[model samples]
Target: MTRKRINVGLIGLGTVGGGVARLLLEQQRRLSDYLGAELTLARAADRDPALAQGLDLPAGVLVADGAAVVADPQVDIVVELIGGLEPARAFVLAAIAGGKHVATANKALLAHHGREIFLAARQKGVGVAFEASVGGGIPLIRSLREGLAANDISHCLGILNGTCNFILSKMTAEGAAYADVLAQAQQEGYAEADPTFDVAGTDTAHKLAIIAALVTGRQPELNDISTEGITKIAPLDIQLAGEFGFKVKLLAVLRKVGQAVELRVHPTLVPLGHPMASVDGPFNALFVEGDWVGEVLLYGRGAGRRPTASAVVGDVLDLARDVLCGCPGRVPPLGSAAEPEGPLALAPLDQTVCKYYFRFAAQDKPGVLAAISAVLAEHRISIEAVIQKGREEAGPVPIVMLTHEANEAAVQRALARINALPFIAEDTMFIRVAG
Candidate 1:
């Protein structure tokens, strides 16, 4: 009943990495019982050598460079927690070359260079587990890559970024301006110092790129995913959305239409009754639709030290079980090798139909409503409802319109025409309505 210990080497000793190490030590007995093998941290590599000073590390373990740790014959598995492109990519490839299984949480690395890395891992006959990459601890990756492998995935919509979600949730709940809420998020450590990646939709796009790859069986071209950030979302818009029975949230949506797959991330208005609408604060939710399963939603902590570490260690345990069973590479990196046939088509915004919410200021005068309605008619964009308010501050009156499913191009053209009219004040505020 005795089994050999699986040696694990860790790269990066920051928040997540530290959490992983602590969890591995704290849960070693249970993990070993489940895995039928002892898992040990044989070595670790961190940028700051002094990071190991206060920690209780095993004796004779090397605190060497990442390359050395990966190259070490003693380390059976390598955990890469150091995020970013260059060194992380190089180190991971080196680990694969050295015949070590990899467990990572780097979404950006996997999104940008996943094909190459997975191909290399396949050739090397090693497992590369990235359960922590997509929805942090949600296990959505496994659900998509394995649990639903039998179904044909038609769509994947997610509230993927926690920082952006936190900011938007605060803005909506507290009626605070974007800047004020973002500052609070930063102060609370929910956001970063330079929150551009989180707030500007880049982070969600990265996660979506990975999820798209898993669902479509093809690497999504990052540039092809049209991205719109949450920066332009105003408190007024949030208030209006609420009055109209909706909530604002940043959503990463991917859908298949015929041969095309439309991938986008933006601030969207979800009906109050929708599943994603209730996923407020620093939480993530994914809604996946398949031909057979219809619709399934996954919700959990999207990020954090322990939550992310839980995912990473879960992958490590899965890999250890495979190693124990002598079933290396039993599952393909993407759950399958067949490339998706045909060109990856994206539905043009104009052609892609959806309900829309439009709000803008207009001059308080007769025929103003008629002029706006005429422009909408000219573009074939139908208005489902209209709310007009008298001037509150002796200027332009506020006009709000909700449109039925319409082409985005027509909406833009109509809005442009309305903006040019002598009565319309400025560009109209438009938000996509989701159910």
Candidate 2:
């Protein structure tokens, strides 16, 4: 039996992009069998044409400008691997405008302008797939959009960033400081030359925003999502968190509180017993809570050339099946694009109640403890446990306290007052406790 061939126009033949091409060639038979259609890479676009010169290519397939690939009558679908806003956005919009089905792995581009792009694709009656945008090969977006579609998603919490997770895992296991672990991560190629986006929590926040929008049917305001980096985490704090039966991880959390949704990414202390606590190294894990499923955890390799390429190929195969059936526009861009009304209200950090771990360095003087307790009382914060380590070789003794669920604003105010005291040291560490 002769199989139908679906031509693919690829953009950005970089690391992941090149991998996608290679995977399509290497697994052509398998993918064809799964999709019940043969897939062919008909055209590709690369900023540097020289980069594509050495690759193995099927006859009649070659590098061309992005527009050439998108506008080609022979091209059936456009796969976007370009990783930015301006040209990528323009190229994607142009592809849809030209009536080409699109697939992308650009998270930043999607996070910021998904609504606009999805709307444009819907109007043109073309499908837009982004399975690789969120968690590499995790298939999290599909699980929420299709598998668990029956239930209303209440919340999603996860260790979404691989670089951040690797750094934190090293710090927790070896008791290394942030700079030292980050340096090691860079040397090992787990982190980028400039890892500000990953370390500063912006990267995870972007992923969180995409997931939140998919689950809630609305685009969340980026500025409203609270963000805190792991740069401030100290080795001593990691030790204390472990002693208290918790692991410190940079977590992206999105939950519904009444009609509002709270989205935040920060360094949180997860209970040792929790599923997320065991997710170490460069792995990613997401715990989703749905009305029917209760809680489900998805864990796997978050990022790598092969893992990400696997996801890209999955989308390509799905699109191939649609093309073969003569129903290319059957599925909507985002599965469903009815924009839900109302601004997504974010709960302030303080009002978002959670247990906390506070570490204080104070003078060995007598009444120091009393003063600290008094300040906490003034703010109506109650302590659940206290561990006071003896005087150190340095200026003050280390005093650690675990508090019951309390408003973060009051805790911050109390910490400010304690910082002003003559006995307390300038440095203190506070981490939120998550269960």
Candidate 3:
């Protein structure tokens, strides 16, 4: 290792990529001072030349394309911040092939195609670091894989999506409708114009798949994760959840149940006193339960250019240290060199037994509540509580019920039967309860 400095070539000078550039430039002194090696910002590539105007990088530091950076023999690390499955994957694979350590913040690319990426890096004897993917600045991946390596993790419950959390929090605080709150979230830059990824739960599920794989050594099939978005969440549901001593949160649950793992993401009625219920806004929190550690909570600003860039820079520094030590891949992609024995069984959502909260808009006429209860009884679902006191006179009235622990399949069947009845004014809505 004749080189005393590690050169980092950066791809994408967009929001996050630009931040990474500033950090590498601004924190170069601190990083070199602390790590005892100069971490150099060698090349930055992006199609938009205008994006490089504000970066204040040297004349030749910015390039027109990523190939220049990936092909640069002087570059020791390639940082991919242009998120998506496409050219990013190509760039990363190319970097690994060139024996350059890689760092990225693309959760979707990792979730859908991580296994192949990890394998390629292993073969090339280079490292791939992605601490910025899951929780922006939470330091979650390294903490779990390294800090808590001694403990057998039992479950990980997380409020993982910032956009969804911001919308839900606004809806809860102002008692506003989902669409209105979503629009507000967009106006505030908390959500994208096309929020299907975050609000529809795909974003969170992708990150959870990474966390689950970190724990179980297998990325549970994304389809088997049973995703549900927050688009259906209403202010009325939020009020009802509050009345029921809970708060609605889009939660990602990954837990070990015996030999199987439960991977799920959905709008959950979290108990009011639970830490997750208090985590509102764009902030994120992960509650990890381990055998020896018992319980640990990681909470922080989970998104934004600065925070995410901090995570990316951390990965760059870590990889730089490895490079300086002449020991790349010191920490394997999934925290170990050995491959997982086999794919772990994923617990079916249908088989899950949990309490549920239901909201039914039924005709104000008589016999509706009894009919609904009868259908629930037919499915062997027993009600724990009900709120039928404020029945309106003119239109369909709201009927709320909290059920005792019931089979998910049974609940869905009962809901189907009840929704089909003529007296039911609209489709009944329900949220799984979590504590």
Candidate 4:
């Protein structure tokens, strides 16, 4: 019996691209046997051809022009690892136009231009596999699309960015400051030099936008999310949280509130016993809640060359099996045209209501707590717990308070009034408490 050969064309010979080539070449026999087809790395294109030197490939297997690889007649699938909107979008559209399948790990590209790209693939009747886009090798997107298809997912909470998680976890465990841990993470290769995107929650929002579309049938813009970074978190806050039996984590949270969806990213305080709180270091964990499936948690290494490549290879095999069976677009694109409700509205952050952890730095004098309590009461923001650690008589003391469920608008108003007090020394720091 003979097996069909699915020729794969790759763009961007970066870390992930090299891993994909290595895996496809080394695991050819196993993958071919599993898919009932021979998978071939027919060609690859990278801007710097020198990057392909280490990957042992046949002569002329790598080219400088990505479009050439996409336009090749022998290529059946285009694996796009060049992570950006311009050329990657063009390359994916070109592949679909040439009637070829695509697999990509570029979450930013998909988050920004997915509607246009998926629509093109649909019109061309080709499959677009993006299993590597979110949660690295955790198979999160597949779980939402297939495994948990029967249930309507109501809420999704995840520690999406490994860099942010690593920083926060180290701060909690070792009682280190955010800056110190971030510096350590950079030295250890967990964080980049700039580290703005991961620390500022933009990277997590991109992944959240993708997951939100998969679950809610609507894609959200980056501006729609109320994003807060870990830069504002202080070591004193972490200590206060530990005292109250809570842990701090940068969380991406999405909840379906009636017809409107609430999307936000911030440093969240989860109960010490919760699974997300225990997911420390540079690991990712997504907690999805559904009507039928109940609660499901997918946890694993969210990023790295090998783990991300594993996801990309999984997508390759998926596309290969589809090509062999003569079924493209077998699974409808996420947020397809057939969704009856169309786009869902994002609930304004002002309307969001949740418990909160508030830290106020003020003079270690009388009437400070009373004045703060009076303002909170005026705004109807009741306090759940309060802890004030001892401080030297020369400096202001830190007062940490956990509040009951309250509207964000009220919290802001109350905080404003509290900040205006004469004894207050610095701006108040607050973190939302996850339910």
Candidate 5:
């Protein structure tokens, strides 16, 4: 019995690309047995060919030109681990045009130019599988595309950024400041030096945009997904949240609201009992609610070399099998045909209604609480609980409150009015309480 052979081309020799190469070489026999076809790492493209990746490749397999790898007649599939949107996008577009299947771990590229790429692949009649783009090795994208294909996904809540989760987990456990925890994360290599993309919720939003498109059948504009960072999450807020039986986590959320979709990323206060609250430290968790499946939780290492590489290789095998079986493009790029209509109408942030936790710095004087309550009353916002810490004679005192479900627009208006009060010492801090 002879097995069909499929050649693989990889771009980028960075951490993820190195892992993919190592896996392809080390597991060639195992993968061949599983796919019933020989999967060969025929060629790879990296800017620095002499970078010493510590992997043994056959002679002449390494190339300095990405376009050459894509244009290689022997390369059947292109696995792109070179992140970011620029040349990676160009390489993917070129591969699709040349009739090569693509497997990428770049969430940002897909988030920004998914429709264009998917449309090109569909028209070219080649498949684009991106299992590593979202939850690393959790297989969430494939689950949504195939496993839960029959159900209607209504809500998706995820702690998608490992850097932010690590910071939050350490902050909660040690009662440390955000800056201190972030510094520790950077020192531990859990966060980058700048760390803006991971901590600012941009990374989570990128993955969320992809997930929302898969679940809701409508791709949302990047700007429409309201994004907020964790820089403002203070240790005091984390302490107060514990008192209210909640934990602070940077969350990416998407839910269908009638004809609109509510997409946003921010620091959220999740109840202690919820699984998302328990997802701690450099780990990722996604909770999706389906009409028929109830609630599903997929958790794993969201990023890193080996885990992410495993996902990339899984996609390679998938495409390899499709090519071997002469069934390429049987599975659509993002689970279905790209919607003919435009982007989904994003539910305005101001119109959102949810429970909230608020922290206010106020003068340690009489009538301060009354003044704040009066403004909330004007907006019809009612308090569910209050925690007023000991007052300081000269320094402003902290007053915390948990509000019942209220309109986001009303809350913003109420906050503005309260901030204007003479007794209020500083701008108020608030986090939406996840339901």
Candidate 6:
């Protein structure tokens, strides 16, 4: 029998969880009218039950245990907003066992244990919708799975972290230090008190794993990705990059090389004319290249209460449709193949080739440039441009340059050798140039 009224059980009443609850309630009539079923919030769970008070949920509808929501026979869809691996994992699995469709935004849980979760849903013949898991509310997953499904996706790169973008944009516009801008972001609630994940690139890497899965039909091991954070970037480097018509953005790159996929994340020097360069201040953008469709870029707010809530609710509606029709897996969870497909061989970073930007803090004295040049030349790395800022007083100065296409291994070796020189600071840094 078709469900005349869909009951939604929500777990987790935190930031995004709260947003989901609000959207579901506020948009109840529209949702019900659209689905042709009276959609209702049957129950909700959170560690702190008091948090649900402000939402004006139906009387006595709030619960303290997620298991209660899962056990409710009336619920046709269970939305898992409680993040993390253990209890969230357990809750989702229990819901699936109960034959309820699941919707989630837990990217880390999905990236780490997606195979198990996806397989479980496939076995149960239920849909696990996660459009909110990456690029919040951007509809990126749907676009990859449905809209652009016809073409072969050759490359995908995104500025997926809003905190990093906000900080970097402030640093670029204000000419302030990274630390100062990070503090400002924290003050403004753009960054967390401990902003390690966002700044360190782990957050973006997690999103990349999901994206690469959609692209290659398999998830790349997190270990296979080369992740470098924005904590080390200095104002001087940003200024130098701008001088050369480039902007620095923490970019997540996944492109096909032969049969293997190359997945990596780091701060990149994007040319000023590129769309990625102009994407600034807490906005996220993804640039995808398909064989037939050419290039497509998606730009959006990426993260926040309402934006994330919008995505989760969208997934909920999709699952609700499947439930009403008694036909699940209308779309695979990963949006590509039904199961995780490839060992999706990830190309070794050492074999990667790209242009690079180098900055060295060296004594303002003769022979420093020649010494650096000799080491780079030895490693077959050629410099394309140079900019040196030094004073007659002969203290430490900055020597910055851009290199032509060179092997990743060669650049690292050359940098290690160059930094080891007596006149050079061991803190010398290098950034990859995006094509």
Best-fitting candidate, measured by TM-score?
Answer: 5
Off by over 4 Å in 5: none
Error of 6 at 172 (Å): 0.4
Cα lDDT listed for each candidate? 0.86, 0.85, 0.91, 0.90, 0.91, 0.90
RMSD versus native structure for model 4: 1.3
* Candidate 3 lDDT tens digits, 22-120: 999988888888888878899999999999887799878999999999999999999999999999999999999999999999999999888889989
Per-model TM-score, in order, reads 0.96, 0.95, 0.97, 0.98, 0.98, 0.97
Error of 4 at 252 (Å): 0.5
lDDT at residue 204 of model 5 (Cα atoms): 93
lDDT of 6 by residue, 16-124 (tens): 9999999999999999889888889999999897788789998877999999999999988999998888899999999999888999999998888887888888898
Say which prediction, candidate 1 or candidate 5, comes out ahead on lDDT.
Answer: 5
For lDDT, candidate 1 versus 2, the one ahead is 1
Runs of candidate 1 with Cα error greater than 4 angstroms are: 62-64, 339-345
RMSD of 2: 1.7
Report the lDDT tens digits of candidate 1 across residue range 1-435. Answer: 678889999998888888888888778898888788889988888878676665677786647688878888988999999999989999999999988899999999998898889889989999999999988889988999999998999877799999999999999889999999999999999999999999899999989988888887777777777888999988988988888889988999887878877888878889888888899899999998888988899999999998999999999988887888888777877888674453244666666678889887888888888888888989888888877767668788778888888887888888888888887777888888763
Looking at model 3, residue 295 earns an lDDT score of: 88
Candidate 4, 1-435: lDDT as tens digits: 887899999998898999998888888899888888888899999989788887898787989999999989999999999998888999999999999999999999988988777878888989998989999989999998888888899999999999999999999889999999999999999999999989999999989988988887667776788898999998888988999999999999999888779999999999998889899899999999999989999999999989999999998888888888888788876734464244447999999999999999999888888989999999999999999878866788889899999999999998998888899998899999998
TM-score of 4: 0.98
Model 2 per-residue lDDT tens digits across residues 1-435: 987778899998888888898888777788778777777788988878776755687776766678888889888889999898978999899989988888899889988888888888778878888888888989988887788878888878889999999999999999999999999999999999999999999989889888887787777777788998899998888998888889999999987878667788999999999999999999999999999989899999888888998998888777777777777767665555465564456777667778889889888888888889999999999998888888658677889999998887898899999888888877668888874
Q: How many backbone clashes does candidate 6 have?
A: 0
Worst 10-residue lDDT window for candidate 3 reads 336-345
Q: Which of the two candidates, 4 or 5, achieves a greater lDDT against the reference?
A: 5
Residue-level error in angstroms, candidate 2, position 264: 0.3
Q: How close is candidate 3 to the true structure, as a TM-score?
A: 0.97
Sliding window of 10 residues with minimal summed lDDT for model 5: 336-345
